[model samples]
Target: MGNKQFSQAQKLTILKHAKQIGPKEAAKVAGVHYTTVYEWKRQLKELGEEAFLEHQPRRSGRGEKEITPEQESAILQVWNDNPAFGPGQVRSQLRRQGTTISIRTIRKVMEANGYTAKQKQNQVSAPERFEASRPLELAQMDILEVTINKVRVYLILLIDDFSRFILGFRLLEQTSVDEVIQLVRRAVDQYGKMEELLTDRGFVFYSWRGINRFEKYLENQGIDHTHARPHHPQTLGKVEALNKRIKNELFGQEHFSTLEQAFSALTKWVEHYNHKRPHQGLGGFLVPAERFHGQEQKALDDIANSRDVTAQIQDIERSIVNLVLAPDGSVTLYLLGQPVVIKGGSHV
Candidate 1:
């Protein structure tokens, strides 16, 4: 089986050559293995005329084709759930769902459906080596810039490295140390704190001088703050990819008049991303919630406290210097969230 498969004419030539000289010497001259010549000699001995011919009989009753309509349906279901999943991942999903299919079959099914071009990208670059073992064992945080209807937005996102869960995200008009700290605070307060936080060496997340607000907040909360190597976004693969998709799906779709509006919309989107969206990283069957917590999913009420957590500074002396209220007695006093006050000056 390891021999270079030769044509019928080539096989006959090799046998004739081996007969004129010796099998080993003929194999050496032909640049083929001695076993190859010996095997051809054996075939010629057994089949004589048929040995050199190309045709072979069909294989015995190949049990109900390995790939069936039912199996194709299962493969399609996996693709529908997560189009980004490759054949290996599809095989993994099939195994988990009590079926075992080869990667070749999965590719065939996907390719038949015209999905191979997208799924089969050149894998010339080194693959992502970083991995997180559990929900809060490690988390990745990053900021992305996106333009929405010509208005630029900065998105601060925190994702659980293991679950591919968007732990927290905010679409803001600008980036600041305060906003990033608030983002981390929201993640900690809701997800019960991650052990380690991975991020790029941005001014907001890191400081060349001893410590910054984000670093200080991490120390206070007992979360280890780690920075990705300068140009290595693959170190934080989950959040980096999440940011790209968010820009296309959320920021690309809507036009927001205010940062507050973007924040509210992002909150809803993040909620769905965590609770509803299935991730191929988690085998295309489980959402981030199901991956993080087996059989349990976090409700909107639980994670939605990010707004109740804080938007900005709250003290009247600190934040109300430029106080202005709408006719409906509504005002956003803090960076934290929309804190409304009545005309009489009491909080609504």
Candidate 2:
């Protein structure tokens, strides 16, 4: 018999009968081909009850095989906004905005748009990585020197070891013990005081003869100060990686004529990094701001529940005027006298 047309309910019943009897027997009794029954079984397994529903089969085409034109446009738009994003990053960004696109689709879209990803270098096995158990447990501090407009300046960065969150950063003409202390103080005042601070044995952070002024300030604030071993950069690997990212992603892309321009650009870049950029270390989805504000668990739960974590990112305004934590585990942010509440992986 020829393959017979079947209604949705008929197809479901046939699938059930196929499971009871052999697929060939069921197909023979139903006046359909055994291959058609097998296909139906596969579809039902893959798509559940929706597989039995009558729908137009997607047409195979050159550009419309996997994703729609609108999705391709979105991929290109995200790539244009962040030229530094790789296929995986592009996919995560789209997923954040409530659109789920595969990495292969994203790559195809990008390549069609004349964007080719560079070959990844073969990575060597490195030492075992370590991070603090929670936020404010240990903070890493570093200084990077850059020459803009033939004028040298320093970028001081302090980041939480647990969340890799930028506690605070400053672009200064000179790096001094006082400037370092001020940055640390500002970070402490903004986020609660960290339990410990980690830094390399620079003259500003450490002294050969005795404790430096920065060390004294840490002691006064009741924060333990620790120094990386001399001549060892891996000890401060996280902060060093951040410096390299700044070099490649920030200064490498944009040219600034004045320190003011560089500072302004750096501020915006840092904001994007903290709030938008996904951290590979944080399971390739969660941003630093979520972890910094103690929303990591809730955010992870949202992912587990198949809910969008983007709500947190969307609701929290950038450059927060003030952050207030409630007793019920909700976080409130005040932006220009407007208060926004975020709780349980969503914003209220």
lDDT of 2 by residue, 1-348 (tens): 432456657778988998899887997788764545666666677777765475433431221233565886888888888888888988877766667778867876565455656888898778578897666778999999998988889999999998898999989888899989999899877777787899998889998997788888999988989999888888899999999999999888888999999999999888888888888888787888887666777776776666777657746532435465667887755442234446665544
The Cα error of candidate 2 at residue 264, in Å, is 0.6
Best by lDDT: 2
lDDT of all predictions, in order shown? 0.67, 0.78
Itemize residue pairs with steric clashes in candidate 1. 310-336, 311-335, 311-336, 311-337, 312-335, 312-336
Error of 1 at 93 (Å): 9.7
Residue by residue across 162-279, what tens digits does model 1's lDDT show?
Answer: 7787777777787999988888887767656677889999999889989998799889887888898888778877788898887777777778777777788888777756665546
Weakest 10 consecutive residues of candidate 1 by summed lDDT: 309-318
